[model samples]
Target chain A: MAGSELTNIKSPRVKAARRLTKRAFRDRDRSFLAEGPQAVREALALDGVVVELFATAEAETRHADLVAAATAAGVPLLRASGEVMAELAQTVTPQGLLAVCRFVHVPLETAVTPGSTLVAVLAHVRDPGNAGTVLRTADAAGADAVVFTDASVDPYNGKCVRASAGSLFHLPVTTGAGAGRVAQHLKDSGLRVLAADGAGELTLDDVDLSGPTAWIFGNEAWGLPEDILALADEVVRVPIHGRAESLNLATAAAVCLYASARSQRTAPAGVRRPAPAG
Target chain B: MAGSELTNIKSPRVKAARRLTKRAFRDRDRSFLAEGPQAVREALALDGVVVELFATAEAETRHADLVAAATAAGVPLLRASGEVMAELAQTVTPQGLLAVCRFVHVPLETAVTPGSTLVAVLAHVRDPGNAGTVLRTADAAGADAVVFTDASVDPYNGKCVRASAGSLFHLPVTTGAGAGRVAQHLKDSGLRVLAADGAGELTLDDVDLSGPTAWIFGNEAWGLPEDILALADEVVRVPIHGRAESLNLATAAAVCLYASARSQRTAPAGVRRPAPAG
Candidate 1:
């Protein structure tokens, strides 16, 4: 635990980051792992966040710019052995750089908004990569928020964060309890809930997605649960013409979210007018 | 390879099915890996194609129905240690079973009609999961085919196969030398090429997707190369209404493909009849 303060975290930070290897440790600490120079760079790019950056001496030597940026930003930079980096990293080959940052908690109250808003809701989606991709898509589609229902994989899971391609830092993503309550809040706020079902009464195209809408995508093993499906004001299917069993959950969510975006994007300018041009 | 000539694989033949592991051997022999009781059951469900099956003694004792089904289907079976099973299987946790079946290449040319065929032209999509998911989406959307441009991942990669969720077997997927030629053939077949771009002139809703169109989705990194973009008769985009950077490739493809499906699905039945009622 030498040089362990926030200003300098070498072995201690590496040891802490390594604990992320177990799901229990990650959950208990409310922290997860992120690796590779790109992931580290993105993590550092976020404002006002405390970060523990671990890099090999070789990496520090070779990528002086990265080290300088980390130092300048006041992020705790740690020198770690390649073996330690490998132990802490998920990839078969560690990229000689990793970051441990606090998980940003987006309050449900903050996520709720009036007027036309788009949000993505995940129900029982356990795969970290799928959850992360959904959040990334939500951000790309300009959704107002992302809500993860109970039993969904932790959005801050290392795999999910990495899968998000750094979009996790850019978006307001909230997990844990109150997801259902938040969904209801959005309902009360006038956003229609549309659950995506492989089999549903309405095709996604048939539904007018231009209005304030929340799209629900669920586990690959099962579509949205029956209760969630019942709660939705509308259940829509992304019309499938081919012979595959079903679209991947993440891909399906992206399609539905983008479909909403398409509808909003193509709305007549007169209809989509900003409030008196500010 | 005992009972190699047996038309119906029974209890006696089960002993002969275990030896097909080495990649060099699998490649030289034109056979590949398959796993899971469900997957094996699925393989047996198909008419008369099971060459051999392998299962741990535990699986044989526990899932008697699976062994019975394999026996009924005349597929040979082999018993192996759990360690051997782990080495032979692609997934980290062995499903206590494996299979070595002759590779069935779905001809790129098969079942394609020149008039009004819709296909996905995948170019340089290096991620195996993305490639497989795209192919699977193409299958689910009932597209005529999926073409892997030269730089795309090998469709046969285990990850690709796992991601495709068995659609790779049914979908008319082709790669390598003939991919560009196939694109040319698709164009000559009167299929208009429409490349998908993050930044493009026509949004998905703006474009009339109801036609014999080949939707081109590109690599995760650079997107559709300029040369490939130039080949397209038109360039189409999925409108981004959110603050996110870009939609994932498979998601983009799904949106385009589903848009096409939606347009075609809503068209008068007489306009495009179902292919001979299956």
Candidate 2:
């Protein structure tokens, strides 16, 4: 049912949606805000839970397709005032539409189970933008899943969601797993956990990526710690042929994931070629 | 020479540095601000003009190497108060160091001269962060130069500089070129002009990138216009094997440039294989 126009900024529904901006409130409710037309549209199409959607009259007209989709799905759609929409939005320029979506991340066991050929693991990645970009890149590279260690930034953060640009809804993401636990789970499952480090002895060009692999990237500033590095089966560095000091976390992850994706795609079917020894 | 401690934010030197935060001031003075130890250190090492340097006491102690470099270069290094540094920095968390660097961009003719091998041209790219990230990627790929069309964001923007990390100093950059002129100049210089478009007929995987090439990328929102796409020798799109709606400006550019870099590196020496006919 369509709710009455929510004019008051402090109305119960508006306030509830606004509270989702806080991590604690999102965790308690198991919901996060997916703002903008692109994100809201994607969330509405997913099989995951989309509790409610809010839009201003302007948005109702501008995003008529999304509104039609919500109505077709029999989901509750609320008409809100500009002030209420702004109050619910984290960005300075709100995109007029926002959806309250339940956490869609799967368990680590489900994400890294057998037959998962490629995965991305972020360890202590503090920047929300970098974390989100990595998720988007991994999805584009067709990685089976992405995992975030407990030390990493919250994937559900508003900025992180914005950076993902709708890819967050396209793939399964597992979060809050311990670095060591993830390494062990992947290894036991027969996947090689390769840590991306600048000082690694093995270069990416020299490493064979034909086998199942889990790429572990680290914090934006400090990169992977020694303890975390020790947990991986191998450590590899992207070759720096130019004078650039190093690639940032997101770009580095993109190159590494794409490399693996290309290798896996071109490898002959049913022939398990051994990876070159580091 | 070390200037006296600049405690007063209103002092002429400090005020001039602060004004550099504005585009008008930067363009008028032909100077831009390079902040943080990494950028400042790079600027000091380059042949580009370093008009002045400023650091807080904490930064002086923390970045003793930079101080010594400036001292050896015979450049004036002013000691400023934290207040002064903060006022001069655009970032919320100032890095305690800043450098006034004269514009180092070359002309289009100079950037894409006869011997140039690989280059990236951005056509009407509006986002400063995207433009900066592309510049860094191009540098890392060992592209000879990067050219920004007049419609693109200013390379000297503080946000753009920060996104480039230290790459803005690593290679020659050119700005204010028209898309048509860049396409023609590159073509005349024996470089193939390839435009990256989502709707392109040619896939990046199928195209041969073994020769000198100039890659043309478009705006973040509306991609290259039909006229701009027609100007190129061929229009190519990165194959999206996954369900991503589309790659962002930066990630797409990285994939394309790295593809070229890899191809050029692997091609046999002294053999110029003709690219597939567009």
Candidate 3:
């Protein structure tokens, strides 16, 4: 392996890693590719899902720590040429490194149990970028978990994995669950379920967000379907005090989650916690 | 006009409208294209900037209100076939409608003035999508204006225009000015200048934002230069409560701006307003 480097894009291992770029293939293999240094480092830090890493000689030199970490964790690090690495990474300017990892999402029960403090649920979110951004936002807010409902995009989609930065590996995620089930779980776990919708009667400012809460975000275009909105205990909207019509999904989610984090952190007592219905 | 549908993508007028898709051509022609129904409607609503409209027959029927709006505003509406419309719009699924409009950025002095409450400045922000999303976030936060510095991406770039939703037309925007001049303008206008950075010594939570303020946001990859950061009265970071390394540009901007909105709205006795420096 000293003088030899993988140069053929169609080489068996290279082809195998490239296949993970497609959603159907990813699902079949239960694996996906994490591109760039940040994502690869985070996946390696997991020390579990990462099966192997492909790096150009330049990337190997640039990311020696990642190579050492992978080595210490018993993960194989393959050396590839620029062309081979480009074939494995989706970005226009390939970062010359990538990781093949098992799906990062866990089962719904394993993601968040009873009495969870903060949560974000993607209900019918279709855009890969939006889904990933929301996940990153949730993680930054210290959310216990993020739920990608049946109608949401695959978390392992190449664009999403990149958009999430390293946050994809930072927190627990539950995917392919139904929105109704997610809402019920949050409610049963003693958290108030809030559907974030543009047409919601209550603005985000109107709520006491210090409570243990799970927020359900809807489709980028049409927003949450009526049934899903009904499952939430309350429908809340991020206030738009200007002439703009509405906030995009990720910004809206951030405003909502950050409000919850600030409020929950500064609450004078436990008084803002939600009470069960009679 | 009912039978005069433009079916050829390269026909004189069609090609002219299509040319706006390229930034150089747009600048030379002093025009840009706003795609999709939401953007087209908003452009028509401006009663200015809009030079003409291109539509497929199906779109004219589907967007009857938009057609009526354009007709009533005396803006020229040209019918095109779906294929021609696709050529004129960059989206994979074109909405079959778009607007040819002049550049939208206003002169700097006219965008904001003394006593302006909230403002956002883009310094060295190169990504068109990020720039547009920040513009939209600022709009939703009811910011007085958005300034795109000389180093920032052009606001008329197709992706930026689309990402801005309709916010491009909702409020005043200043573009192509130097960041230093913009910061000085904000200071002279009696507003606090805050730079949002990941490594700022002051977290957003540490400052009182209930006052007239202007925020300078840096590049997606590198952030602000030392000279630019030094120009700010206070450098601020949105607190990351969890394991995420950092928030994306748009989400961070939203968190900061919304915090200011909430603080300024709820401030009593105007006590949080900043005092002039010695």
Candidate 4:
């Protein structure tokens, strides 16, 4: 194996790192961007994470343990100059290190365990940042899964990936067609489907979230679609006690998911029902 | 008072509106930016809003009732073209409507209600979006005030303003120096000060948040400073069940504030602390 030190701009290793700026390179090459020490650490910690790791000479010396772990995992390493590293990096201050991680597809089915008490379904959420933050919150609240419905932002978008803070790797997330179908399936499977809306009939505090359930968060611009709302057994809302017309979409999702998690915690343990006669 | 329609490209009114893109214009004029029908409705609903209301001819016609209300409230009105409106708009899709609102200065002393049971003291949070969302969440969770100590984003920055939805209007927020001194004062006034940290000894859910209290949220990059942490009677954290390193600053604030609110709700009516005593 060639232990190439990429000193020049034209080096093939340096050129490959620069391609991460474009989506085509990220998709066609099946490699994506991860920046900053914390993010790089997260990517390193995950199994099957590194395809190619890049760092400036200074970062290589400073984060020797990190580089060693990647090398031990049989990952290819690229050393670039600080200037080159900065050019290849996404964030303003790159910390002189980055990684091109192989994207792992999260499974759609079985993402939510049958015994899980709460799941979050995002429908037509266009903003990747909002979608990713919701996924992170769901992970924080220990929700079983996050389901992305039709027309939603791709969870794999760079901004979304960064926003998830690697929670994307931890949570069971299902993205694809027919989120409505999944909602129906959860309902038929005996999970309560609660849709979140500003004009919802019941406040989130007023809803019973102790049972197996799915909470739906909709588009930041439009709130939930009528079809999704119709599928909901009950509609719940985060009470707006102040003059803010609406909370940001991500904030709203965090509050609802946390509230549901709290509700479940406070409820009697035996309240969870057995799976409805298969 | 000339009745001539204000349609010309170089009209003084149109030129003045265009100047709002400069912060000095926004400040010196004692007016800031607001747009879209929804934002306008919330602003109009709030007291002490809208010094000047600007809209395209079509917007004025489409929202005649709103226009009438603005005129009745003695707000100055300007008519501009869609192209002209975009000059003052922050978003990509200009709503063909905008409002120049008077900046409301909330006094810190007044914001700290005489007998409030809970509030949030933000220390050195620099992100405008994070700061504004914190204020909005504090409002939703029914906290008395959001206090900023030391260097932090201006709570009224356009991005912060937009992020707050209309919460900026309703919530009592005061910013200035001596946050630590004020926090100590809060403790002396019989309020518990809970500081959130990633490695805190106590879990947020385990803390007794039902008492009169002021929760402090710190900068996103460094968490709370040691000096500020020293003032906290209790340091608590939201236990992370996933691999994500930490929750977003606003999301963390919401979770903490809501947990406190939840405990207050579940407490025996008599056991909960009375409003803070002056």
Best by TM-score: 2
In order, the interface RMSDs are 1.8, 1.2, 0.8, 1.7
Error of 3 at A154 (Å): 1.9
lDDT of 3 by residue, B253-274 (tens): 9999999999888889756565
Model 3: fraction of native contacts: 0.86
| DockQ (0 to 1) for model 1 | 0.60
Model 1 segments beyond 4 Å from truth? A1-10, A20-33, A61-69, A269-278, B1-27, B41-48, B55-74, B77-84, B149-151, B197-206, B222-227, B235-240, B267-278
| TM-score of each model, in listed order | 0.83, 0.94, 0.93, 0.86
- Model 4 error, position A153 (Å): 1.5
Per-residue lDDT tens digits for candidate 2, residues B128-247, read 889989999899889999999988889999999999988899898999878888888888777889999888899887788989889999986788998899899899987676777777
**Highest-scoring model, lDDT:** 3
For candidate 3, the per-residue lDDT at B130 reads: 92
Candidate 1 docking quality: incorrect, acceptable, medium or high: medium
Tens-digit lDDT track for model 4 on A32-144?
A: 77776666777888888777788887888898888888888888888877777767776677787788887755555577555667888888888888888888888888888
lDDT of 1 by residue, A1-278 (tens): 11432322355655677787677887788766777876667667777454677778777777677778888887778777777777778888878887777767577656656644688888789999898888888887888788877668888777888788777877677777544676687677777889898878898768877677888788888887787788889899877666666788888887888778777776776554232211
What fraction of the native alpha-carbon contacts across the interface, defined at 8 angstroms, is recovered by model 2?
0.56
The order of the candidates by TM-score, greatest first, is 2, 3, 4, 1
Question: Residue pairs in steric clash, candidate 2?
Answer: none
On DockQ, the stronger of 2 and 4 is 2
Task: Choose 1 or 3, whichever is better by DockQ.
Answer: 3
